[model samples]
Target: MSAIPVKSKIPADQQLKISPFKEVIKPTVPHKHANYYELILLEQGGGYHQIDDHQYDVSPPTAYFLKPGQTHCWNFSCIPIGFVILFREELLTRECLDIVYHLPTTISLSNSPSLFELAKQFCQDYRIPASQGVLNTYLQLILLKMNEEMATPAPGHQLFSPVYYQFKALVNEHFLKIKKIQVYAKMLHLPPAQLTSICKTASGKTPGMLLNERIVLEAKTLLSNTHLSIKEITDALDFSDASNFVKFFKLYTNLTPGQYRELAFSRQQ
Candidate 1:
């Protein structure tokens, strides 16, 4: 099993990259970026996109968001015309992070010409080597526009809370080592039960469930994409031993780690 390639599409010296989308002439293998977020805006396209566990159709006037460490691949039946925007965490402000945390992985941009124009402008200005400040402003506006299109009500208008988003960010950063709900609650300065309630209300999942899901997703990615042995993966994931890792994985996926790897490889063939 060859390791799944980790790609860095953005140049080393740049914190952001904006370019027009070009048709993929060959099948894209599953790969991930260790840092940065990718926003793809398509004016028109065909086929489907695989992001982690979700597969979304290549609909015209659609946007796809890929976060750091998430595996993704594209299989386009026809040429795709759009722009791909890549930005590192340095480029995100608190407000922008709020918007990004809430944006769905896939967004329908139909009836949203402003977004397309903004993306086009972003691509063009990127070539001019626009000032970082100007580029940051454009990125913020694009995110704000997408948030508006989501039609999410104001903070008070909805049952949502920024704490939930904060919790999610924390989990994304620490899920590999911290698995306790109480620890997360302590970090958030909320009681364990209150944190559970907030998570359930906001996303229909308990904090523990979310943590487990993240662990499971990472395990699957490693199993499917890398040649690491079971014991190696267990150690990397901080499991006590290979047997315990297999048991935990089976509980969530109903398949042992090796079996899951075989299934994943079969699908590729």
Candidate 2:
């Protein structure tokens, strides 16, 4: 069975859902949210969080912000206590989205005891009167504080340019139809060499590699979440044929489509 993309399942009329990490089952199957962001306030846990292709060790007392459409899975060694706050894209203020929650980041919040308490209060206080507004306000506070925690630059390395953000935006939009770096470079109005330089400098990968990352992410989601056969997935993804799609998936993931699907599903069990 393929793991289909799960759109947020929180009941309608409510824009937020908060839960604790103990409630989260282990080895969360690889999946993506089609509509919302998952902000995990993991105060206690020991494991690895797989976001897209990057695996981050779960250092207790860390805050993880996952953007929409990104795939993730969890492998925690023990039951952890923390709140997982889910919010739709619209709930975030424009400034918050653009500034605070632009990318997936996990940083230790152990030093910010007050911040942790605030999150705890949010989870506990949501059942009280005006909970929605209260939660929204709490979310805003959490984002702002997390922004401060993330503000420190990594020593000796600079974050990528806003240009790379533009590139990724284009990639997210057209990864299905456009796979070539040249097309994306032209669209960005940079020469291929210039585009390559920027991409390599920013992410240590070529624009072409980033393009493939997006496609493969979607492919993995489909394989794990749906029952569609390889041929159907090929057609759904606009591939010329099943064989070509298998070849493409294998080149990046080192596993054939069938193998990947089985592996992801087995872990879900």
Candidate 3:
């Protein structure tokens, strides 16, 4: 049940997915893509949530900001109820988007109940069939409050800028098809060595390391959140085969995907 990440060929202003599903259907398995950002409100159920390398037990009043390329998934005792607002980068100018992006995408609303309440209210208001102007106003206010409350960005905040953003966007799109830094270098029209230099400067990691991080993040998300067979997850991720995915998982996590999933679920019990 992994939802493959889709690239937005369309512009952002016209691209938003808002819905309320109460059917208790399986949640989308953890996966990653670029181009879209999400504001999620979990008002029901409890589960293991993996966003990037960070995992937590998601409960009512929990809010998470999911940026493009971060993987996520859930494990629940019962079907969950939540509000998910998915929007894209180009929907707003970089100045405004930077405010929200600077907020750590993974956060616990329980730490700030009042702010959480305000977020819920904002979501309610945005859901109304209001004029574009009104909706944009509400969105800005919400982001402003979040920015005020969010902790200062880490020292490496520079990684969130244009070149780094472009690099990450590329990883989200091609991590499966291409595993080499040289491949990404070619796609970005830069020499492999130059790309390496840029990544090291921006993220304090080599291009290859970042690519592997993206792949491992996706692997963990799928293993913990979805019902997909190992073979399916492996194939979808463009592994040579399941064995390769398994080998890589073991190399990084020191556990098989099945073992990791079993332990993750068992912890919830």
State the C-alpha lDDT per candidate.
0.84, 0.76, 0.69
- The candidate maximizing TM-score is 1
Question: Hey, what RMSD does candidate 1 come out at?
Answer: 3.4
Model 1: number of clashes? 0
Q: Write the per-residue lDDT of candidate 2 for residues 1-269, one digit (tens) a residue.
A: 34455566576566787766665546777677755667888767787887765678888788888876777778888777788888875686755655543544777786687887887778788766445677788888887777667756222324526577678878877887887888988999899999889989887998888888888887876777678889888977779999899999999889999999888778657
User: Please, what are the lDDT tens digits per residue for candidate 1 over residues 1-269?
Assistant: 35557899988778888899976645688898866889999998898887876668888888898888789888888888999989976778877776776678888888688899888888888889889999999999998888777756224325547788778778877988898999999999999999999999988999999989888998998887678999888988899999999999999999999999998778656
Candidate 3, poorest ten consecutive residues by summed lDDT: 1-10
lDDT of 3 at 1: 54
Q: Model 1: what TM-score?
A: 0.79
Question: Which pairs of residues clash in candidate 3, taking residues 3 or more apart in a chain or in different chains?
Answer: none
> TM per model?
0.79, 0.67, 0.72
Q: Give the number of the best model, judged by lDDT.
A: 1
RMSD in Å for model 2: 5.2
- The residue pairs that clash in candidate 1, if any, are none
Compare candidates 1 and 3 on TM-score and give the better one. 1
